[model samples]
Target: MKVKVLVAAIGVLAVMVLVGCGGGETSTTASTAASGSTETTAAETATSAQPTKASITVGVLVPQTGFAANYGPEAQQGIDMALAEMGVDSGVEVKIITADEDVLDASNTLERLKKMVETDGAQIVIGPVFGSSQQAVAPYLTQAKIPWFSFLGASKDLAGSGGTAFVWPGADQLTAGPLGDYAAKTLGYKKIATLAPDYAYGHDSITGATDTFTAAGGKVIQQQWVPLGTTDMLQYATKIDKNADALLMWLVPSDAASFVKEYRNLGVKIPLLMFLGIFDPTFQEVGDLLVGEIGLNEYNPNLDNARNTAFVQSYKAKYNAIPNQTTAFAYTVMENIIQGVQKSGGKTSVEDLRAAMNGMALDTVIGPATYSPDGIASSNRYIVKAAQAADKTYIWDPIETYENVGAPK
Candidate 1:
């Protein structure tokens, strides 16, 4: 997998658009301006470091327009939040140069990433969120000898390739696999109908669920694949088998919202199991209808651990919105890079950073995370429910936690 999965659209379009960190045509050079927080202390002190460099340039490849647009800004926010916590103003200056990760035409990503590495001098590059975008650009990342990290995740297909790593809770199948098991063993869902956008990520995620679902004695009576970028979900919704135990769906953001409207309009009441669908931005629009529904998530804002508490508080204070998985992962990947630099005594070479980061355990917003040599992350996953909170605000309440979750063997 190349910066393989887990974009905001990793669930819907954010799941599809996801997020990446390569450079592109329309660019913004910026940095974090927020005050210090404990996360800054955590990232810096998480590993031993010498602030050797005054500044480092990071190139971001995220789609600024089209299906994945909802994810890019938040991902940048995550990077900024992490940089601030690492003391951007007070210490190391991290420069951000953004490029559009054109999900439509991936060649654009490769061309722009070249500028990021060659012309702009991005020492550590962040994205190219979609799997196809990552695949198009992987050769250059290796050729340039730039040690890159996925703000989202790279897929399992890119595993063990040089100059890269996948953030576990990454690979789409890994993140959703437990949900398949959960649907069978915990929820006692015996038969279900599945729906997802027809794409690599969509196929991989639903497979993650159904593969385990079937193994545990569940049957998927029907499977639907909506063409990527199709917004008319009513047609797909109308075709679902109402008698199945539940409907499992993963669409891009717009498509997901459209699907919900049609699902409700049709009074399709079989219940729902979604991949990160009932969360923010999405929840902000469809929360009222999704109450009591189940979804799979890579990050939950309600986590109570010290690391997550600090991350959520600091992030909310800075951005005034609950940090979604995109933001959280962006923050975590930045920490991974910064810490690698620190561990290697400020070496920016990919060879050095990769050696430093791989297998170096650290507390992340999503809990314990460590990168394997192949660049796959071993992290955690969540089974969440959309619940109306006391404040009448909608939140993805984590009902279960699966530790050290990674790609299924």
Candidate 2:
């Protein structure tokens, strides 16, 4: 899709007046100045004082192929929607360039990112979905001096001091920590177990949950890691400690659906507490089996607020599908960047944009959010449970909300 340009009325009027005036001959005369003083013309001073119009190239790096491809299109949709809303009259011309960040390999993703910055001249980068991909390309991004707004939820280092000003939608600790507290303190699950894909995100998520759960006097009885793209989860399912109070786990949507089905078939009765992934659009395919499963996330389609309501309505009207976390993340990132650019008088420089973005607070579809000095975002999070209506459609019922959730320091 093309980026729609919406010119401001005042800008249009100015252009029209300039066109009507036509060209007129003018004489350039040097004016006298005092000793040790530099003479400057009124026109020269005015031109020099004007803020330079910014031309920004944004690189959209998401997995358009491989396991995570399902999310890439929606991410793009969100980007387009945000840009359209910000309009082209913000004294900046934004050009979007896209490249696939293949989920199976981080090296390829890094190469693509390097090409985007060095060859495509992308001043800002939006994503490279998976946790490992983000980690691999982080140092390169820092060296390139490109600001990245990532959807990664794995490493705290990505948002730590002295690193690239990389922003995340919501870090793993933000979602997992609250859910862990809810699981142990609220649901009274004293002994828990976890199952997750063996990667940085999985490690971060499990650690976050375990830390919070153990602190609340709960014990983690067992933990299992599944390789990415492992279709048969029966081995892991059979190993789950049935005596545990509950199982906390997450995987990519397809793998998760398959694993849940297999686990259910294996007659594992431990309740499931999920961290992200489960609320994906693919969850509808296994809704009946997933009923009553609890999860935590930063965004949900059913959130009732003016901004979310309008966003959901517009997204559905345009795409004919309900929006998911990926869409929300993409939209929020783009909106934040646009706001930063505006704050800097359309300055696209990495240093200037970073200064403008740090400590910015905005009310987004996910509710009020703020960017920390380290570039991590803090926002409201929801604890949701899957439920099926009489019509047999699944809905994420938000049972609890945690405000201003951020990554652990």
Candidate 3:
């Protein structure tokens, strides 16, 4: 009986061991399967967790249907050119929104800017072409944390304030310094006569010329400020008499044309130096009357650079329109922003894009371009002579190219 009981106990113990081994194997298999499942789920979640799509919405804050309507289509043409170069594909969509800022009143200007920023949700802003409009939009843009760039005559009042706005070609210095220096040093002009519209743009330009010319051992013999849109400028032309070596006229399109017409009529033989606005379509109405005028241009259509040549060809083909200097600057601005976005992996955040813009150095059709945090564009300036093209329209022939005028140190 004792032998039989011991054998039975041994058999019971063997069965128990077999059951425990089997259970252990099953548990290990289950844990391995669970771990694999967990890893697959995590990978799936990661694949689904990418950031949302980015769309580029730029606010064209120019006067499209107001006093500056002549400049409206030109501004739009610039943006269109930039968008084409940027290439809207691979999750980037460029949307341009336009606003009309009435050039007559400050309130209307501010209202239009506010609509573009708040109502339209524009991440970038282009213009409000006049000085007053730019001044009106400054505080709003600063508070809203939106970047604003303008195309107008330089205003020192707009600069040095740590504002959210930047002026291309650096308002006063870029426009006036080079022109003044060229006249003073290269052309050997001792006495310069100045005439510009009585406004911030004209005043700032005159101030820049005055300061730079004086510093470079040149004398400003006489300075005259005239009201804008003055139809009869024979009286002003009479101011450009035998005493002045050269006349630096800084009027806008209409007034400048009038002055040029009257100067020719009055037979004033002194060489005239003027700004970009002096060569607008209206001035071309005066035709060969402005054959020998020497001026500073924003960008010369006849500049024989690879970029300018391509731009002109593309512009004519794409829009069936003649390109101008303002449009060129506008194109440069948009291209600069698009490059910044592309470099940042298409980031939509303003801060990231701003950082990208600050670090960017672009090769523009106008010339080399770079911007500062203060919103100043330190691009090159062009000096050109007005010559009638074979097409019988006035075109600027680039005489000197000051490449990279405002490069940061």
Candidate 4:
């Protein structure tokens, strides 16, 4: 999954998250939120008021029929894990309605979301998973007064005063800016070339790095944007600045596979700085091919924390495998919704829930989660290296962790 889970000729700005499905996507509670006050006291702010509703409905959006279709089942698995954890006796009844994110068509995304809210009575929703889809459906969420908890990632700018949008794991820029810094100051790259899908999430992911990279005294000599559904990379690959120290790339699953295959065949010797998803476990070729390369990671199932420990145990017990980034993002969103409803005494009104739990600290699979007044989120970001596991499968190996990071500087 692209954390941005993005691609398409859609306009910029996209969300559960707005940016990546797997890195090309977005999320937050794996750490702190807002100005960080919620980390220690979000629980204290919960109102002890009595129940206002016996049941709450949550709408979940996933891409079921596009290039990102594989991500749907993973998200569902995460949602199920959260539901099972919430169980049947948590006082508030949780009903779930499903819809396709439809990242390809903004209009379809809006239409489906409207049905979820207007007909199925979803009070809060998770996803509109791609950045473009999130952008397409956000205004509707605001007008309907429903909280949009992005399981993917979201733009900080979209989290305006409506208090209806809760962006987790910060935005694309927040996620990638650190890599910029690392590349400049740590990796000591002097110049770099970049390639990404020509869309909202791609721009944000690249800009996040270029901003920090430029600020840290590195030059981005060439930047290439690929259109959606363009899997053939010969035209783009031939033009890469061979003189640049490295090439940074981000793309949807299929396109990423296509481009890497082309890049390898060309025998380009430039070191690579990949955005997330280049090594997604789902794509065995890219992961195995990129082994030993460095990249940004939104989630690593191996995160060491009691909450994560328990989360991994439960997920493994159920799925017999580790939850990937997309699954973790969905699980975190579901956990937030469940906790918010429980803490606010089953109050599911859009405004009531936002007021009751905005910036509330959550121990999510990602980490501790919190929100800004404008709904921007905070969490952990990781710098990881691609490595092969014992079974010959590829996995992200965390080399460094950035805790409680909010938007980029």
Winner of 1 and 3 under TM-score = 1
Q: Could you tell me which residue pairs clash in candidate 2?
A: none
* lDDT, candidate 2, 1-409, per-residue tens: 1333344655775654333211220101100111011111212232354443665677788866545667767787787777666544444456677777756667767877787789868888888777878888988987877778876454667755545655565676555788899998899999999998898888887888888899999999999988865778778888999789999998888788888889889878889998775748688888888898898876888887889999999999989888888887788787788788889887776677767877787888988887776777777888999898677779788899988777454
Model 3 over residues 244-306: C-alpha lDDT tens digits? Answer: 888988776666777778888888889988766555657578758867667777677677778
TM accuracy, model 1: 0.84
TM-score of each: 0.84, 0.84, 0.80, 0.83
Can you list the residue pairs that collide in candidate 3? Answer: 154-171, 166-375
Give candidate 4 misplaced runs (Cα > 4 Å). Answer: 1-53, 277-281
- Compose the digit string of candidate 1's lDDT tens values, residues 1-409: 5345554335565433433333322444321221123224434542335443545677777767676777777777787777766753233455667777777667767887898789878887888777667778887787777766766655676556544544545676676888889999999999999998776777877888899899999999999998765777878989999779999887777778888989999988898998753444677788888999888888788877888999989987887878887788788887777777777776787667767777899898878887766667788888988899999888888999888777434
Which stretches in model 2 have alpha-carbon errors above 4 Å?
1-52, 152-154
Per-model C-alpha lDDT, please? Answer: 0.73, 0.74, 0.67, 0.72
Cα lDDT over the full model 3: 0.67
Task: Rate residue 294 of model 1 by lDDT.
Answer: 88
Model 3 CA deviation exceeding 4 Å by range: 1-53, 65-67, 89-91, 152-161, 228-232, 345-350, 407-409
RMSD of each: 8.4, 16.1, 27.0, 9.9
